[model samples]
Target: MGDSNATMVTEFILVGMSNYPRAQMVMFVVFLIFYMATLFGNTLLIVLIILTPVLHTPMYFFLCNLSFLDMFYTTCSIPQLLVNCFFRRPTISYTRCLTEMYVGLFLGITECFLLAVMAYDRFAAICNPLRYNVIMSWKVCFQLAAMSWAGAFVLTLIPSQFQPTQFCGHNIINHFTCEIQALLKLACSDTRKMEMVLMINSVIDLAVPFSFILVTYGRIGQAVLRMHSAKGRGKAFSTCGSHLVVVSIFYGSAISMYLRPQGKTFSDHDKFVSLFYGVVTPMLNPLIYSLRNKDVKGAFWRLLGKKMSE
Candidate 1:
């Protein structure tokens, strides 16, 4: 909130399981493969959402934004992680760390809310089919997407505005990047406010989005059960199934990571939980929706077959 900038720290050292020698090399290769897949998988989703007119609906519109955010989200952390993991020396400056955190948090938080919006879109489409177009129109979709990004920036960027606490005790962060939790751990200040901010953010992030997703699915399940024909019910379920599955993975990891940060006797698990959303979710998103959805499959095949002939 201050016009003057906070004093920047020089660099960050990523302490990624330094005790495990051979494991560090192994992790580097594994994460490399994940990064490659994350790039291609998410890029394809963006293209599919754009190139296919059938996919120009509000659902796909939001999905393209998700892919875009996921692309940056994974990119912000993974490549730098590779340097630390493989090269054995990973350091990031304070300004760079805050920037990464800003971008990473915004993208991650935006995706969380965007998923909620997508759930609502699916909800209106299935539960109240009579006004799907009217309810989830282009204008509304654009507004929702903008709101997601804006909300994330306003909420996260505010906390990051403060100067980083001195890490004189231990300058090493155990994880890959300078995430809020890891950064806070390095802080030598009275971080009660920072912790409170994170707590409040967690509540809003989990409660609002989780509630929306659940209610959407609940209405969707209700509508599906009321179907007269088995085929009709299957059809309805199929339409929402891919999205529901995606929402589950995306939200589940996110909620699990952000919700109960204190109950754990250990914090090492944060790395794995970050992987689910930061890496797996991005890579799996296109695959999940494309492989599972019939129309998307048809579009993929049609696009592929046409490309091969050309």
Candidate 2:
């Protein structure tokens, strides 16, 4: 019966950030700028890594995957957001909404696992420098990346399977994007089981990976402290700094958004938090990595020099 009722609701209205006419226009322009920056910044990192042979190591290889993920992550929702902001009430088809939800889940979960994989890479580099190359070889790196992609895609399917059957015809999603939590709010049926499922997924997706990263970094910290040379310690810190910053931004926003009490009232605050992780964080990652890492800067200059000579 619920499934039958869900079919009647063919579209959903997205109640975006601002109801005010002027604010909607302002937000559209602001998000347009953010979307453009996300594209340009992530693209630059990917191209620099690809064009520069010096960046062909495991660390940059993972960074390349991250850049590609960020590219699609933002693209999955921001363009729709930009389009919706222009209208008083923007509607998304049931199929399109489901696609957006699944795509976002796929990319978000993949990033969570990818960050944990990166933390392991750093641990190998700093804690066991002698064995870093052996442990993080091309084969191993490829396997880890593949696992992150495949694992996230499969895990995302569970939540998606629960979606179409649950949205039993309240078609107004009070958020800009078709986020899992936002869409869950519109469901007319019992959400306790679904929320429990999402919560379990969140724990596995966010907490477990975060705990792994923490343990990896803890060992890395001890190794860095034991280094007698200040130069060695500084190098280790520099190597890990960009990743640490990126992780903090990514996990901080995600945990805040997802790992909360299910009974808590949803608000416009949720929308802003989603925006931070979805748009702001993606745009910031490339800047954080490029500006903080000398290796990437040098690669950029070397690439530019070659381009100039041609």
Candidate 3:
């Protein structure tokens, strides 16, 4: 009987922005533009890094990974969101909904680990310049990137296995996507254990990385002050400052959504918060890095000039 009840919900209706009928078309246009820009920016960055030998350093390698992650992250949910914006009643099958939830979870956790790895890279570069190359060699970079993906896989897979597999008759998801919090609200089974799992995952995936980044920057700050060369300090600050901004934007919105008290009813505020991280942050990442970093700008112009000359 319990299993039968769980199997009852075959599809879910996504409320999305349907509540604001006047804004649906406007939202659709805005999101479409954001989505296009995200793909173009991240994709261009990835190609630029690969083609420019100067960008073959460990920092850009990690950046390449981040670019790819951002592209995938936005692709996972935004297209569905755009399509749903056209309909008054948008629906998704159970299988796809769960798939989206798990995939988003995996990518998000991977990013948490990846960001910490990037911080360590920055720390090593600033604090141990002589050994920077040795410390962040291609082999080490590969290993760190691999470990991030693997760790996120284990973390997402294990906790997800313990979550409820069945939802009660209610199938309306208030948010645009099958966000875990919204999905959990529909579950017929007791979700206390599931919420506990989410809380633990949040600490490991959100709080830990954020704290590590803060500490890493603190050490970098100390190293910068010790430097006698203003030029060198300026360079370090330039690089680290861009990364810190990215970290603040990504982690701030994410922590607010995931680390908050569990079991509270999901609200409009929560949806917008998720939007900031999921849609806004990814769109902003490549722009932030490329605009702030001289290397990226030079590489882009160089590539363009070469093509034109040919």
Top candidate when judged by TM-score against the true structure? 3
Q: How close is candidate 2 to the true structure, as a TM-score?
A: 0.95
Q: For all the candidates, what are their Cα RMSDs to the real structure? A: 3.6, 1.8, 1.3
- lDDT scores in order: 0.78, 0.87, 0.91
lDDT of 3 by residue, 125-206 (tens): 9999999989998999999999999999999988777777667578999998989999988887888888889999999999
Candidate order (lDDT): 3, 2, 1
Better of 1 and 3 by TM-score: 3
Q: Model 1, range 201-230, lDDT digits (tens) per residue?
A: 877866788897887888888888887889
Q: Candidate 1: TM-score?
A: 0.91
Q: Sorted by TM-score, highest first, which candidate order results?
A: 3, 2, 1
Candidate 2 — which residues are off by over 4 angstroms? 2-7, 164-168
Worst 10 residues of 2 by lDDT: 160-169
lDDT of 1: 0.78
Per-residue error at 250 for model 1, in Å?
2.4
